[model samples]
Target: MIIDYSEQLIVQEVAPRDGLQIEPTWVETADKIALIDQLSHAGFSRIEAGSFVSPKAIPALRDGEQVFAGIRRRTGVIYVALVPNRKGAERALAAKADELNLVMSASQTHNRANMRMSCEASLAAFGDIVALARDVGGVTLNGTVATAFGCPFEGRIEEDRVMRLIDQYLDLGLDGITLADTTGMANPRQVDRMIMRALHRLTPASLTLHFHNTRGLGLANVLAAYEAGARRFDAALGGLGGCPFAPGASGNICTEDLVNLCDEMGIPTGIDLPLLIELSRTLPALLGHDVPGQVMKAGRNCDVHPVPEYVRGL
Candidate 1:
């Protein structure tokens, strides 16, 4: 299908939350706050600052409240927090999270494994969370359908199942919806098909695509989503993320790589690529290991390299 891509795309930076949640090394709360502050200046309209789930479940992000309280909140950028249930939603609201991102896997097996509940139970809990958000009265909610493309535990997910989840999200009055490729099992063709179907029912503004680079098709999937008229995407700095619960799930789509791709293609992402690349470069030292982002190693297209003397002579 021919797709006329939008001139502007919304890149929601999820590094602090999804990116840091599974890191083996502990990043200081101060460092995480600092990173969010820096990213806030890089023109991201939405940033997943942290998650409000049980610290026992995700020890890495135990400092979610502190991080939210510490960061210098920008005027236009919305700070989001991932919430698992009503308690999490209440905590996120207390922390002044601009948006709450609630997730449930489309595959029942995966949902049971990840959230320890049946798919119906998870949706019911999400309803309570949405009610809590309404009571709070200032926070927006985003419903994320995890494993929308495919699942490692359950294999391919059905399109009808995904559509039903989206219907639930809309019925719950969620301000946004995200289709997550939780294990990076999505291909470009699959992405296009799913997103096109979603677009038939939702607008570009309310929909977001969360892709992983585990199989090296993250950016390709983004392109496909864009072709299907999706304008919002979720990405992590330096591709620093994986799901400890989901088997074989690896890095998220790199924030720098996605921005660079948009810049090269004349797509307006409203992000500063050089600033993002600089942040990506610091991950190796911060996490005590090199990250998976490519832009930090390859540099931008405009970054010309000097020719070697031998090559110049030739």
Candidate 2:
């Protein structure tokens, strides 16, 4: 199939929410705010700032409200918040979140485990949340199809189900839809097929692909999705997140790596790669561990090395 190589792509950084949610260590409120402030200057059009879920459910991010309020808001940047239900949506709106992201897993078993309810219940909750956002005024709504690619417990999810979810999301009057791999079970071929069909039903403006590097194919899937005319993506700084409820799930695709790949391929991502790398380098110190971003560690492909004196003499 023919590919589109010239369009600029969108990468929504989800490190603050998806990345930090599953961390065992609690990132300090000040550090979390500082991290998000640094990310805003990296030229991200959108950033998942935090979540409005119950603190008891995800204690690592228990200070979501504080984190969102403490951040230095920047113009031209949309700060997103993951809101689980009507209550969470109200909290997000009160916190002035630019966008409200609602999620439901494609796998029934995974949905019950992650959302603690049936798929029907999640949809019902979304309807209420969507109405609340509309009533609140000036807030955007985005629906996420978690485990859209595969589920650890249930295995493969039917593509028809995924397509139907997209339709339902549109019917609900949401602004965007994110198809999350959840556990990195997606391959390049599968991404192409799924994304192509997905693009057919909705504008690329409303479609975002969220992939993980658990199987080392996250970037490959991004390439496939881009080649198939899908332009938006969800990546985390340092590849720092996974589903707390999904067994064996790993982190999301690395933001620096994704931008580096786009830069290498002559694709414009509008993100500051060096600045992102600089921020990524700080993660290890802040989180007290190494990150999964290769570009942050190895530097970009354009980086030059100095020749040794012995080699010069030789």
TM-score for each of the candidates = 0.97, 0.97
Total colliding residue pairs, candidate 1: 0
| Per-residue lDDT of model 1, residues 1-314, tens digit only | 64554479899999999999988898999999999999999999999999999999899999999999999999999999999988888889999999999999999988988999998998899889888889879888899999999988889999999998899889988988999999899999988899889998799999999999998999999998897789999999999898765666569999999999999888899999999999889899999988889889999977998889999888
lDDT of 2 at 170: 90
What TM-score does candidate 2 reach?
0.97
lDDT of each: 0.91, 0.92
What is the lDDT for 212 in model 1?
94
lDDT of 2 by residue, 64-143 (tens): 88988899999999999999988899999999999999999999999998999999999999999988888889999999
Candidate 2 residue spans exceeding 4 A from truth: 245-249
Model 1 TM-score relative to the real fold: 0.97
